[model samples]
Target chain A: MTQGRMGASGAPVVSFENVRKVYGHVKAVDGLTMDLRPGETVAFLGPNGAGKSTSLDMLLDLRKPTSGTIRMFGSDPYHAIKAGRVGAMLQSGGLMPEVTVRELVALVTGFHPRPLPVEQTLKRAGIASFAGQRVDKLSGGQTQRVRFALAIVGECDLIVLDEPTAAMDVETRQAFWVNMKAEVAEGRTLLFATHYLEEADQAADRIIVINKGRLLADGTPSQIKARAGAKRISFRLDRIDEPFLLGLPALVNVEIRHDLVQIQSTDSDRTLYALLDAGYRPREIEVSGVGLEQAFIAITAEDDRDGNGTTPGRSDSAGVASYAQH
Target chain B: MNSTLALARAEVRRLGRNKRYSFFSVGLPVVLYLVIAPSARHYHVYGVAYPAYYMIAMASIGAFSGALTGNAQRISQERKDGWIRQLRLTALPANAYVIAKIIASMVITVPSTVLVLLLGRFYGGVHLELWKWFAIGGTIWIGALAFTALAVAIGYRFMPDTVQPIAMFVYFVMSILGGLWFALSGFLAKIGDVLPTYQVTRIGTDLISNQSVPATAYITILAWFAGFVVLAVIAVRATAETV
Candidate 1:
C-alpha cells in the first residue's frame, strides 16, 4: 500500500534493487538489493575494494549506478537529498581550511531548510570547546568530530556516514559512539559503512556484509554469528583423538595444534557437554562467540568456493547451513 | 536566493582573508600600474594622451586578471580539496553555485579596478570628466565577464597544481597580444585586433576619449563571452558526470 515494498511498520526508508555500477569492464557494485527500515541502525560491513563505498556513492546520488534503481524514503536519491531528508559524513573530504569550525558549521547549517541551532549542534558533537579554532588546525579526531557536527546540523531524518570513524583514535572512537548513541536515540534512521567488524558489531542493530560486490550475509550481529554456526570453543588437552573430536555433536570444524584443541560449533554448550560425557578432560576451556571478523572470513571463503568450485575444505552441512541462514 | 547570497558572501570573505590572493590580484596590479603609467605620461599615441591610454589599459589588465585568476584558482583548489563534492551534495542548485562564484569574482574585481583608476588619476596625472571615469570603469568591469567564464572552464578542467601557472601564462600571452603594455603594429596588430582583451581595452579607451568604438569590437567581445560560457558549461557538466 505504501509504494514499492513495505517493511514491518510501513514503506522502507531506503531500498536498492539489482543496482549495478560498472566502470569499464569491472563491476564496482553488482546486483545489490537491500532495504533499510526507518528507526533502524544498519552497517554495511565490507573489506577494502568490496564495493561498500561505491554503494554509498550511488545512494547519495554522487555517482549514478550503471544500471538499476535506488530509492530513499520511496523517492529517488536525488529528490530525497534535495528535500533535505538525508545527511552524510563523507570519509576523506576536506573542509574549508581557513574558516573557524563555528563558521563552517554555520555555513553548512544555512543550506538546510530546518537546521538545528549552531551552538547546540556543536555541543552535541563534542566540539564546543574548539568552535573558534580553524578547521586546518584541528587534530584528526577533532576534525572528524567537526565533520560529525556538519552532518547532524541539518535536522535530517536519515544520516548516512561512510567510514565516519576511520580517522579517529581509539579514545576518540569511543567518544564518537557515545555521541552517536545520543543522536540515534531520537528515532532517526542511520546507515554507516565500515570495515571495522567491532564497530559494526557494537553500533549497528543490523549488519549487511558484502564481498566482491555481492551480499554475503544480512542479519543482526548475533544472528549473523549464529547463522554462520561459528561459535568457537577452545581448550587445552594433553591428548585428543582427532577422529573422536570430529564426531562430537554440533561441531562444524576442528583444529588441533600442539596441546590446544579449538572447535567451531553451532551450539558450544552441546559440544562442551559432549566432550565431558565422552570422558575427555579438556582444561582451560574458553567459549567465545565467533567474532564478526571470523564469521566474515568464513562467509567470504564459502562464497569463493561456491563461485569457483575449486577450493574444497568446508563440509557440505556447514556450507548448507550458511546458505540456509540467509 | 538566500543560499546563493550566503555562499557568495562566504567566498568574498574568504578572498578578503587570503593575503596571497590580495597581493597577486589586487596589490600587484596597482604597483604595476603606478610603476609603468608615469613613465609614459608625457607621450601620445593615435591622438590619445599617454596617461589616459595607459590608465584604461592597465585597469583592463587588472580587472580581467583578478576576476579570471581569482575564481579559477579557487575553483581548482576547491575541486582538489573535495569542497566541490560537498557542495554538490547539498540542496543548492548547480546554477546557484555558478552564479555565486561569478558574483564573488566580480566582488574581487572591484578593488583592483578602483585602485588602478585611482593611481591613474593621482600618479599618472590623467584627467577625465566624472561621467567618463564612471563609463571607463563600468566598461572594464563588464568586459571581465568573458574572463570569468574562462576561469570557470579552466578551473573545472585542470588540476590545482597546474591551474595557477596556466592562468598566469594565458593572462600574459593575452595581455601582450592585446597591446596592454605597448602599441602593436603590422602582424602583431592584426592578432591584437582579434583577441577579446584587445576589444575590451578598446571599449574602455574609446569611452574615455569620447571616440565611438566600432560595432565589430562589441560583437567580437560578446562572441568570445558566449564561447567561454559554453565551454564553462561543458566543463562543469563533464566533471559532474565523470565524478
Candidate 2:
C-alpha cells in the first residue's frame, strides 16, 4: 500500500550487498543481501542464532562486515548515521544513568542537526509520564521505553529497532505499536527485528525470514504463509488414488492413510475444485488456516532439517501442526 | 563540535549531582590540608615552605585521584552497560564520548584544585605571586588531564571489576611514590623523579622557589601524557567492534 503511494522509485533507505560477517570459524552473516525502500515498515523475522542481530549490527556499522558492503541512502551506513539520517535502538542499547529521563532524551536530541522538540518526542514515545524519574531507577519495561525514546530523539528518515518491545507487558505492547504506527505514518522507513510472529504479522508491511544466516523467504504476511503451504485440507474418501492426489493443484504436501487423506495446499479453493474435477467425492471435508506462527516454525524447521539431514524424527508439516495447536 | 560540548555539559551536570564524587575529589583535599598544613608550618621541603609544598601535593592528590579513579571506574561500568554503544547510534562524532569524558573530568578537577589553593593561601598561609598561583593551578590541571587519558586507556581496556583494583593500585602507588602523600628523600625521591605525579609536584614547588622548572619535569609529564594518549587510542580502537 505504501509502495503504491510513494512509488518504489526512490533510492533504497538501506541495502546490504552480499554482506558477510565471520567470527573465527563461524559465519555469523553469510552472503546476505536485501534492500528496504522508503516509507516501508520491514520486519526481520528469524529464530535465535539466525544471524539477525549480526546483520543489524553490520548494517548500523557497530561491527565491521568481513566482506561486502551496506549502503544507506546511496552512502555508507556510518556516514548516513553520522549525517543524522538514521536512528537505531539495539536490544543491547542502554541509557545513561544518574539523569532524569527528560535530561537523557534532551541530551541525545541535541546531538541531531535537525532535532524534534524533546517534549514532543517524549509524548510520542509514551514516556512523558515518567520524564522526571531517574533513568537508572526505572523498571525493566520502563527502561525499554526510555531506550525507545532515545531512538526517536532525532529527526531521522530510517528507524531501526531490535526487539523493541521485549520487556513490555501486553497493554504496554499495544500502546507501543499504537505510538509506533504514528511514527511510521510520517513517511519514515522502519526496520525492526522481532521474535513475536503475530506482532510482525500485524505491524509489518513486508517480512523477511532468515535461517542459518541465509534468506529463507521475503514477502508480505500472506505470501509468507502461502509459501509454507498456507492451508490444510483433510477428508475421508471411499476410493483413494495416492498418485493422482499428489498431482492436485496447488498441493504442497500430501499424506494418505487407508481411506483417509490429508493435503497441504497454497490455494485451498483451487485444490478443492481440482479434486472435484477429478471425480473424487470426499466426506467430512475440513479446511483450516495455518497462522503465521506455524508458517514461521515450518520455514525454520525445514531449514534446520535440510541443514542437519541425519537427525530426523518429525517433519515440517508435523511441526506446523504442533505449533498450530498451540 | 557543539554536540560534543553539549554532552560534556550534561556530564558536568551529572557529576555535580554525585555527592560521593564531590566529597572525595574536592572536600577531602580541603579537610586533609586543614589538618596537615598547620602542623608542618615550621618545616620546609623542595626549597619552599612546608605549607607551600604540601599545598601542591594535596592539590595534585585531589585532582589526579578524581581524574584516575572516578573516571576509570565510571567509564568501565558505562562501557559494560552499553552506554558507549548507545551513544554511537547518535549523530555525534565517534570520538565524542572520550572527549566529553575528558572534558568533564577536566572541568570537575578545577574547583578541587582552586579550593585547595585558596586554603593554601588563607588557611594554610602559603602566599604566592599571582602568576605563580595561576601557574600552579594550571600545572595541576594539566597533570590531571594526563591522568584522564590514562583513565580512558584503563576504562576501554578492562571491565569494571578489574578497573577498580587496577585504578586503586595505580592511585596508591603513584601518590605515595611521587611524594604527594608526604615529602620523599634520597632513594625515594630518586624513584619519584621518573614519575609524572612527582614531576607535577616538583614543577609547582620549583615555580614557588623562584628556580627555573627542570626540563626533565616537563618532559616526564608530557611523555607520560603522550604514552597514555596512545594507549587510550589503541584501546578505543581495539574495542570499537565490541562496543
Q: Each candidate: what lDDT?
A: 0.81, 0.89
lDDT of 1 by residue, B1-243 (tens): 898889889888888888887886677777877787778767775457787778777788777877788778888887787777776667766666678889988887888888888888888777888987887777778778789999999999999789989998988888899888786678987998888888877777777667888999888888888999999999998888433
Worst 10 residues of 1 chain B by lDDT: B88-97
Each prediction's TM-score versus the true structure:
0.92, 0.92
Residue-wise C-alpha lDDT for candidate 2, range A1-326, written one tens digit per residue: 36622257688889988788899999788777788988999899999999999999988989999999899999998999999988899889888899999999999999998899999999999999999999999998999999998889878899999999999999999999999988888999999999899999999988888777767777778778877799999999987878889889998888899888888898999999999998878999999997899889878887787767674323443343334323
Candidate 1 residue runs with Cα over 4 Å from true position:
A1-7, A237-240, A274-279, A309-326, B241-243
Model 1 captures what fraction of native contacts? 0.49
Off by over 4 Å in 2: A4-7, A234-263, A270-285, A309-326
Question: In candidate 2, what are the lDDT values of residues B1-243, reduced to their tens digit?
Answer: 999999999999988998878888988888989998999899999999999999999999999999999999999989999999999999999999999999999999999999999999998888789999999999899999999999999999999999999999999999999999999999999999999999999999999889999798999999999999999999999999987
lDDT of 2: 0.89
lDDT value for candidate 1? Answer: 0.81
Cα displacement (Å) at residue A280, model 2: 8.1
Q: Write the per-residue lDDT of candidate 1 for residues A264-310, one digit (tens) a residue.
A: 99999999998899898889999888998887777777667675766
Candidate 2 TM-score over all chains jointly: 0.92
Scored by TM-score, the top model is 1
